[model samples]
Target: MSEAALPSRPASSLATPLLILGAVLALAPFTSAAVALLGGAAIALVFGNPFQGQTRTWTHRLLPLAVVGLGAGMDLRTVARAGLHGIGITAMSLAVVILLGLWLARVLKVDRDAGLLIAVGTAICGGSAIAAVAPVMRARAHQVSVALATVFLLNAVALILFPPIGHYFHLGQSPFGLWAALAIHDTSSVVGAGLAYGKQALEVATTVKLARALWIVPVTMGIGMIHARNNKEVAADAPPVKKPWFIAGFLAMAALVTWVPALHGAGHLVALAANRALVLTLFLIGAGLSREAIRTVGIRPFLQGLILWLIVASLGLTLVKTGILTVG
Candidate 1:
């Protein structure tokens, strides 16, 4: 008989995963992902990681699906126009951050791997950037962990801090969204802060940040090329590079919403579902942040990440306020 026709499994067999899922769903309505993630992590910290095996499934499978689902709510043309308007400043911000981060890293006496990881994470998309370039740079496992911890801690802080700062300055939706997209380290934090400000800000922030994330490809590959040129040999232990293919899916869903006649009527529903999925994704992401992981983040790397992010945030806002960077 097929599994569908078979009897249900014993409750003991499904308990942990079910509990975790239930918690996520139960908390999804009232709280933002930022809060949900913290709550999930706090629960895990107290009770131990109940969903250890499933953490991989959430990060690799579910998170990308959620991001793609988000595209269904977006108007691709508007996202594209906003992307074009912001691309120049985005690229410039990345370049300045990386150069300045590396220099500051030297001044701070941090080593090469930590410096590069922090620089890329600041210049591009936080943990994802660190993960992407770590293997290419032949970074040690400890180095990767420390860098990730630094970024994750700062990401949580940014989610809390950026929204109020934006409001305090009385920023318009477009400007606040652009500032969040440019200044925040991770996609979740950017979107969370944007959502806190307003719906229009959320849309603009998500689009611009995802567009900035596309730099992962060139950034990692370029680092690989530079390493090979300087060392004259490729590391045998280097991990295979994976492209951010989900970005294409995100863009495709946006196009489908913009162009497909049959799907047009359901756009609102689709977008709503996507937002819920993103929140669920964030909750799972939070549960993955363990206490042990947080403890391992050294003071030096953390300081490096903190300084770099503050500079990016301050510089981007200054440009925005001065009318040097136009908001869409």
Candidate 2:
């Protein structure tokens, strides 16, 4: 009986080891921002591909959900601050990115839908934006995969280059933070850029990043409505999800943060966990892109990212410099 039970124990025992591995990878440096690259690399090398027959299993189903669990920390402070203004910003940014990028793509002879997807993703919250708007626009999976790749590459580049650029310009903490939040692709990128600078910069970057994230909802809704009117025929299966679940989760999390601030937990632990989740998630998304998608997207999306980065920087600087938004 003991011998027979020993065989069953192997499967049970694997969980501990996997968890330990995850923990170590997420903290290889013990105390540094590079831990993200470390952990993300470990996951990518180990369980990266869905077709590898690992993530397809019942056990691996929790991985995407774990990524979703990052939503639990959304908190209300982010929501209350965003409110009506956030809704407006989301509308404006999405409209701007979609209209401008799509027009450019058409002129360049690129796929209009793919171009629009890339622009929205770059301008808003990165992958989430692409993931949300892709359905309404009838984007191919590869298009999304490509859009993410383009944004992810730029994000990694921004993480490395933006800090020194910020320093060279002698941007103050608040101005630098806003610039990073606006220019960078996502929260993790913003945090990485901010941390590379200082504490005050980190706080400022996060505030602006969250502000940017609030734009996803209206943007998706707006895009969806436009699609409904414009597309004469769309597959019944297309635009599968009614709305972006993450946006809903994001909003709910913000509400929780405001109404149930008690649940935010201690500052250090929750903040640390949230930051870890943000970094790991972003890196994983970047690594998930297919090679074919990269070949297809070419320089159109990259050029769009560069253009948006410039716009975000100039706009963000003006907003801060002119006291459009208050930062302490």
The candidate scoring highest on lDDT is: 1
**What would the per-residue lDDT of candidate 1 be over residues 117-232, giving only the tens digit for each residue?**
98999888887788788877877666777787788888888887888888889888988888898888877778777877888888888898888898898889888888767674
List candidate 1 stretches off by more than 4 Å.
Answer: 1-22, 230-240
TM-score of 1: 0.87
Ten-residue region with minimum lDDT total, candidate 2: 1-10
TM of each candidate vs. truth: 0.87, 0.70
Worst 10 residues of 1 by lDDT: 1-10
* Clashes within 3 Å, all models in order: 0, 6
For all candidates in order, the CA lDDT equals 0.75, 0.59
lDDT of 2 by residue, 1-328 (tens): 1111212211233433553455445433243444454444344444443322232232223223432344454444543453444455655765776677776667666566667777787778776677677777776655665576677677767777777777777778877887787777765677667866876787667656666676777777788788888764764434355333544554555455556757667434555565565544434443343343345557866676667666766676677667675542
**Quality of model 2 by C-alpha lDDT:** 0.59
